[model samples]
Target: MRIMAFDYGTKRIGVAVTDPLQIIATGLDTVHPLQIIDFLKRYMQTEQVERFVVGEPKQMDNTPSQSAMHVKGFVNLLKKTFPAIPVEMMDERFTSKMASATIAQSGMGKKARQNKELVDNISAVILLQSWMDRKIY
Candidate 1:
């Protein structure tokens, strides 16, 4: 089984998944908000997912951000859609900025750093990795 993470957005949702061994997270795909469940269904057909980790955006004070409402609604939908699977919310503060910095530092070039989809993908990876890190200590 694998652990999946999502950096949810109203427009685009970034996806990442851990290896079967739960060793590391890797970028999967950027999915449309409307199509995410279907996309996940198709992915589940071939891959056994152990849990779903959704990014919960937060403000500097650690309160829920404006996007938190949307994320909560999405989480409800996700639970309804996949009743057996457990879902978790993780703070996503600065994941995007971190991703952007990572891209800029990676020397993937100017155009690559400008790609929101790429940034989202990396953010999801970071979210999952953060979760794993928290579990360790």
Candidate 2:
């Protein structure tokens, strides 16, 4: 079975997927928030995703941020839409900063770095990897 992860934001949703064996996590794409549910529906049909791990934003003091509530709403929607699949939350802190640094360190040109969507997608990959490392053997 494969697991899917989402780094949800107001503007975009970054997606990542684990291998069927649940070993590797790879970035998929960044999609507009309005389109995320439709995107998941199409992708899940083909990939047979078994679970969803969503990144939940939290403050430095480990308190849930306002965005965490938004994420919770999204998770609730996911459960309603795909009741058969289990949904889990992963704490996401500094993931966007990490993604920005990795992009800068890659020596990409300004034009490429200006693509916010790319950074979101990379952050989603990192989020998924972190979640897997924390929970999986």
Candidate 3:
């Protein structure tokens, strides 16, 4: 079984998946918000997903961020749609900045680094990896 992660946004949702061994998290793709459920359904047909890790936005002092309400709504929909799969939330503060730094260090082209979708995908990877690390140690 594999684990999946999502960085939910109004326009696009970043997706990531763990290796079968649950060791490494890789960026999967960015899907439109409207298509996330359908995309997951189609993906699940081929891959056995064990759990869903969703990025939860929080304020610096630990209060829910403005975007947290939207994420909570999406999490509700995810639980409703995939009752068998457990859902988890991981704090997502600074993930976007981390992703941007990662992209810069990778020496990706300026245009690619500037792509919001790419940032989202990397952020999802960061979020999933953080969760996996926490679980391991």
Candidate 1 regions with alpha-carbon error over 4 angstroms = none
Q: How well does each candidate superpose onto the true structure, as a TM-score?
A: 0.97, 0.92, 0.98
User: Which residue pairs show backbone clashes in model 3?
Assistant: none
Best by lDDT: 3
Q: How much is 6 displaced in model 3, in angstroms?
A: 0.6
Each candidate's number of clashing pairs is: 0, 0, 0
Local distance difference test, each candidate: 0.95, 0.88, 0.96
List model 1 lDDT by residue over 1-137, tens digit each: 99999999999999999999999999999999999999999999999999999999999999999999999999999999999999999999999999999999998998998999999999999999999899889
lDDT of 1: 0.95
- In candidate 3, stretches whose alpha carbon ends up further than 4 angstroms from where it belongs are none
- Report RMSD (Å) for each prediction in the order shown: 0.7, 1.4, 0.7
Per-residue lDDT tens digits for candidate 3, residues 87-111, read: 9999999999999999999999888
Q: Which stretches of candidate 2 lie over 4 Å from their true place?
A: none
Against the true structure, candidate 2 reaches a TM-score of: 0.92
Query: Positional deviation of 101 in candidate 3, in angstroms?
Result: 0.2
